[model samples]
Target chain A: MKDRPLILVTNDDGITAPGLRALIEVMNELGDVFVVAPDSPQSGTGHAITSNATIYCTAITIDEGDQIEYSSSGTPVDCVKLAVNEILNRKPDICVSGINHGSNSSINVIYSGTMSAAVEAGIEGIPAIGFSLLDYDWEANFEATKKYVKKITQKVLDHGLPEGVVLNVNFPKLKEKDIKGIRICRQAKAYWEEDFDKRTNPNGKQYYWLSGKFVNKDKGQDTDEWALANGYVSLVPVMFDLTAHHAIQKLNSLGFNEK
Target chain B: MKDRPLILVTNDDGITAPGLRALIEVMNELGDVFVVAPDSPQSGTGHAITSNATIYCTAITIDEGDQIEYSSSGTPVDCVKLAVNEILNRKPDICVSGINHGSNSSINVIYSGTMSAAVEAGIEGIPAIGFSLLDYDWEANFEATKKYVKKITQKVLDHGLPEGVVLNVNFPKLKEKDIKGIRICRQAKAYWEEDFDKRTNPNGKQYYWLSGKFVNKDKGQDTDEWALANGYVSLVPVMFDLTAHHAIQKLNSLGFNEK
Candidate 1:
């Protein structure tokens, strides 16, 4: 018999997070799962990798699952890199990240450690997906989203993803019956309005804590924000290419070489 | 007279990097400049922001210039946030990051701390640009690229950039005479072939050091990779929108809700 598909699992909420455990439970039904994730929470880390410091990875047993788990002292992206390069015996058929406690929608994808792991895997030519829930609470209910997760994962394995793309799947925080359905949508044009809390340090020096309010400026009904707001799971096929193809012509008209 | 454009300058290279200095010099001629960058090098930080730890920021006078400079204990994105939310008296007219020590071309844009700062600025409704040199050296010459930098910065000031978009400008590492001018291009379909050096730690732990070779798969002459190869500066207008607009239709066909 052919071996079950090798599925690599990871998340930014750390290996011990409840969200990671939920993801593991879902993936176990699909394939031979190998998990490599950060030992501590790495939310908002984006695509950071450890360059200035040495990365430490260790094999660990997280639960009673058949899947093997490894914990690492690195960012979410680093975890994927280490897993694909050092831990995994062969290239995995798929890489799945998160089922995160918080949303990785719209601009959050750019700041998400969960999605970064998936994006990194996609860069390595592995089909990957990042899943998140709309609830930010640590005790958010994920049981309701498990069916959709399994369905999506199975479908991806049945028909592979396109090159240079990964899925950013965000589920609305509601009862399964309340979820209207899934909508494949564009990342909404949204941003965080930063508000740094300024204070004095013990040494009489000034310091600041980073804080922000999410602002969605785009009024488009076809955006991820709209889908999530209307009780639908949002799936955005995300690409790492940052080039703005539309603006290139305008830049050429600037006469960059004119003396 | 209208107030000088408040231009915020920053880089992934530490505050003392030659590239940052060159950027400051260029912005000095254009507007009121504020330098808020990392105290140490923050290369490849992507869009990371400090959350688990306290951020320490202090004002420091680097040289005899009218521009204000401050060093921060944060990543490139944090520097931009701190500058806009705390340090700067007003929202800067533009935010320019990195005349970087190395290129942030093609897929490197995703892992770039330089571009993250620019992306952060763009998210905040400030026109942004990230500048880089093809040569990855501490003392790479940037003198010849000054004129082009001025021209582009001026055009951006005059025309303004589209919302949620920023420029990723990469200069070819050649003398002005040999340079073929500039090309507006898309991010080349390129990636790093990860080569991790696995070793055992003194504590009997397995560790990995990240290393890679850049592999450009796209041969299109209209790509940033080709532009850099042909001795032309590449201007790729980058957007934070990670959504694959074309995939929406394909995903819609999946019937995700059909149980």
Candidate 2:
């Protein structure tokens, strides 16, 4: 285990984002880091890939760093695919995404490009983790997140993740000392209650601004939303297999075969 | 159940696509249909929503049909959100997406806008199903898929879907007489073996076109890929909860709280 591990780092907030830079700095200390991320912000793009068009990626240095980096004209998921299929000579020991500029707790994970990038890596049999800070500001302090990031990344590299699983980790916006310990939890049953602000355009056409309120309906203590709200970093193990195995029997009983 | 059911219909291949129109026709026989679909093809958009910009939607009639329709300048998931939040006066009994022009069985589901629309509807507590045929042509014949689509949809309407679950149905590209009966199966373990075609642009920059071959590594006959290949309509009960519940205990054993 003395050999240095190969690490792939990426984020949904684009290559030049402070959140990604913070992630790169933390990962640089642990292993050889290669960054393949979007050229522009792609926050809620989910698991989207660039299938309808061609993607352009450029090799460039963003700062005084040892990490090899590429800026992709594609989504976060596309970046991961491109990294694994086009850029890297070998599969990395671990893939880490984000240290994102906002929260991806509970239902928010469904619409997150950060988690999607990690999930993409996981689908390709790589141990992966997606990290998010509970702050949306571009200049939000990532100082308190560094140690935890290092700890979790080290633990995952030491002990590979279970089959078909990836980690969705979120940090509460607290100072290093003030933050509570990390908690292993499930995703809470929460949703964004949307409120579409409708308006008319100069061309007399109708348009809408999709805004929503985050509504956490679950009262369970063993959930990510509860952990994050209580100032702990929440880690939820997520998978790509979306099968509802328990419901299969009931669906089978409906007897579609019956005349 | 004597009152006519309200059915919300949509697709990733745009509102006027032949596949979407076929779905609408089949749905029309069972209930009052309302269409809210993308204005253009949105394949591979996954669970993306319109978060970074304004979305424009307009009411239009694509055919001499009884269904009311709207085309939105957003992704497939956005069409669902728009339909439920702004377009429909009351919640539809069921939401159906696609009869998509390509196969969305196994690993393809992760990157499919067709499944994403259905998954979005499931999240909103609406019973939903996404249908696809194993053909990618714009003029693919959907005649053999109609009977199965009708039966599955009718069954769903009669027996409500379990909470957090939706259905993914795929038919083989066979003649009506050659198709076998429908089979209930799990999603197959599969992935795309990506082959990125690198090219030099006129500006002397390199670009890549994402292409891949569908690789089904699993030999299990109880999987969707197997069922589809065997000339059957495959139905897999899909869920919105991404939590890997089995990995929770393993993750908890990490003891991140130890002093």
DockQ, Cα level, model 2: 0.83
lDDT of 2 by residue, A1-259 (tens): 3398999999999999999999999999999999999999999999999988989999989999889999999999999989999999899999999989999999888899999999999999999999999999999999999999999999999999999999999999999998899999999999887889899989898899988889888999999999988989999999998878888788788897665
User: Over the stretch B86-181, how does candidate 1's per-residue lDDT look in tens digits?
Assistant: 777778999999899999999999999999999999988899999998878898899978888888898899888876689999998888888787
Per-residue lDDT for B23 in model 1? 89
What local lDDT score does residue A156 receive in model 2, on the 0 to 100 scale?
95
Expressed as tens digits, the lDDT of each residue in A50-106 for candidate 1 is 877888888999889988998999899998988887778799999999989898999
- Give the winner by TM-score: 2
Error of 1 at A59 (Å): 0.8
What is the CAPRI rating of model 1's predicted complex? medium
Model 2 docking category: high
What interface Cα RMSD is found for model 2? 0.8
